[model samples]
Target: MPRNSDLTPDKALAVKWINDNVAQLSRDHMTIWNLHEPSWREYKSSAWYVERLRAEGFDVEAGSGEMPTAFAAVWSNGDGPTIGGYAEYDAVPGASQDPVPRRQPRVGVNRHAAGHTDPHSALGMGSFTGFLAAKHVMERHGIKGRLKFFGEPAEKMCGSKPVHAAKGYYNDLDAAISFHPHSFPRLANSCFWDTHSAPYWSRIYTFECDNPETWQNAGAVTGVAHGHSAARAPGAIDAVCLMYTSSKYMKESMLPHHGSWSLNEFILHAGQAAADNIAPGLAQIQYSLRAPTLDMCARVFEVLDRNAEHCAAMTHSKVTANWITRTRAGLANHAMAEVTWRNFEAIGAPQWDEKARSFAREIQASLDIPPMEDPFTPEIQHLTAPWDGEKAFREQLPSWQTNLAADDYVDYTWHAPTVRLYVGRPTLRAPNPGYRYPEWTRHAMGGVPACIDPMWLTAGKVIATTILDLLSDGVSLDKAKSEFRERTGGGIGGTSWIAPLLPADFAPPVHYRWPEYVTTVRGQEWTIPTAAP
Candidate 1:
């Protein structure tokens, strides 16, 4: 913490203001959660945030990163330093669950539609409320600084931010601050994540089966000795299957499994299935890979590219890899973390009242778990270091490990001083002799305000205070920048720095077949919900 200056009155007022307005904030959070749009298709969700930010007197760029749903909202007061925060609104595909104790899917819709399992509803809420709270304090106190809240959509696909970074969105900002709802032991309600994670590369490889004659009868003709019937050539579907299975077979040989690298395949449907024994003309497969280092990721991609080529050849098709989302490893800054942690200790844990406890017990009892006076752990209401995780990462990899998981928010670390503050959203718990709480129970808790509002309010306090510090104290900002410069050897163009992985001219994969809600004259539904009317 910076030399213990007395708590700024304006900052105190800002925290109070946010606490008083938690009810309104909770309503907004539930609204977004109910939308539950996935990936690049968070149209309603993005528009709602943009409209809310504008109503709070922010200048919003509705579509900033060449992505339709991606946006940035700006508010400033004569600009001493420009600080940034962002919100991720995209839900995951096939994770549908309503906020109920028992097993429940989207009512009158899909049982496997997109839902905010990461509970991004609360994640986006904390960040956005922080933005508003900071705006309130700065405006009231006449604080001289610039602030921006980015409407980052498609985070589930790791989309948008890299495009923003490459296009010079975060260039003028002094620092970027972000927070997430984490369940990792000791990481909850504490503002600490130094040895964070590395880059995750997501790309789509498309295979086109244009020529059928070559595979079936390159040596024979349609009306030749084969009697007008040409032996069938394996099509794009065959090629996709070959590529998928081949990568699975080659995965063990691809990496040494030392640094926690993984690659996953997703087949995309982009063409009509041919009939009359004709070869399929088009098929696509996406691969999202995470690695501790860029070199490791590169080596794995090379093997994948080669496998795609061979798979295409075997099925008489052509393939191309379309780069979608690419993020670099996180750059850690202890100075920023220290400031945020100091605020975390000040705010203490979220106060889970008796009402919340009863609701949690209700969910637990539905699952046949005996309810205790406290089903949820009281420890989560306090601050703790992520000791176990930090130790495991150290033991599993080099002590200098920087990245361990996959997230596009890590992109901010590469550009400027970025800090990730973690807080615990409410999670359902099971006692001894009982199994873990079902995912729906957790989802149920996440949607309820009594459970998640504490997280949102506490996170908002940390964010508001941190931004207040940067605005009120130049020394803190300088310390953060100094750490950033030393870490990057001079920053963005520094000798030891990493550049944006996705090219500036690269195209986003918006045209591909991503899972989205399908609307028709029969009303609305998610992905043509596989349920009877």
Candidate 2:
């Protein structure tokens, strides 16, 4: 393998490459909505990165399977077990953005306040570094093996599943490693890994009610309408609120350890009308439910369905629930984790002191939070301790388990060894910290060219070196996989390291509520405007 010193030089080069190319990269991927499109922004970014890899002597292939942007590039010495490094560069809609000097008018009108905080941008750099490091190791040690870089896109809504189904990307790989940037450095044993890193399922429910004159005639109908008639009325607003409230209650009652439920989008079909006269004809709601295992997720869905049925009966509305997407069970390869832990220990990354550990214990006690009942927690700190497993397992309650129908169940098996790493970043700390939207634009645009570029490059070096170590002298894949599974089992294990807390201070809240409106040009047909123009 290349000497650690030789691998060090590439880190500086990686940063320079990211800085020099970030603007063009950002612009190429820019869209009317600023969210990634699998065929557009994501595909183009993949091509661009692949071209860079080619220039560095890696064998690059663009457009894997039906996915236009998905690609696999390989560098091999002669013949050996293949190791996979993955990257994703998709951005979220309405996330924060970098401000520029010129004010550009809105296009599709959707814009992010903070962009790429999920750390996909860093993935590009990290994967690149991994590939480079693997190449170096093979050359130095004359090892006959292959290093593969998989450029994955559209992970925002778990877009990789379709690609996986069509291309079978993971079927052939011996092992895979990827990382996401968060608010702090965490080891595999941490609770953050356990809670957030598990496989999950998403359910979207749409409730539609047809009541054009219910609100307008509500008062006119008097006492008869207030009770029995009102019960029969299909009130869209009531249905939406009822469903939302019921789901919240259900989630609390379930008290699941590895699952979460939340409501996202709500669309009401009232058209443009005064509040008293506005009788909505339709209401659509999006709900997300996640669990560590598919069976758990399925159980949660059963509860979700029961809750939905109850809401529908109470509100007298028709509801349809659908599974939009599902991710495979998270693989906590014991072998890979131990190697990573050793690396972290050797590097002397921050360790939890006894006082800090005591403080965490006190916090848990104060909250009456049983010791890590659920594998996941929003509190990223205190997630990494070997001894905490028994306590965590003890806290798992029976009520958390829900009965599931045959159709609702899914197996919880992973195809191969996988490890997901998380790194801390600035945007994740405070998404909007009093920075004007315009200022945010400037920060995003300028910051990418300055900070992100170099940071990605540095990330690339670290990841690349790690890959080299694993490929050359690090450890065997089978051994790593066996060890990782033994240690983590089906849980995130423990908690020790905590992510840095968000600053207590709040930014001046931007008070401008999204104005409801519909605009029509000369050639447009006449229509009632939805909001005050």
Candidate number of the best lDDT = 1
Each model's RMSD to truth, in Å? 2.9, 12.8
lDDT per residue as tens, model 2, 181-287:
43332332221223224344555566655653443444656555443344235555567777778777666665343333332443423223245443444555655
Estimate, for each residue in 65-146, the C-alpha lDDT of model 1 and write its tens digit.
6788889888879958899999888888767887777788778777778888878888899988887888888888889999
Using TM-score as the measure, which candidate wins?
Answer: 1
TM-score of 2: 0.57
Candidate 1 regions with alpha-carbon error over 4 angstroms: 1-6, 218-229, 274-276, 385-400, 433-435, 530-533
Query: Please, what is the whole-model Cα lDDT of each candidate in the order they appear?
Result: 0.80, 0.46
Between which residue pairs do clashes occur in model 1?
A: 197-403, 197-404, 198-403
Residue 90 error for model 2, in Å?
2.5
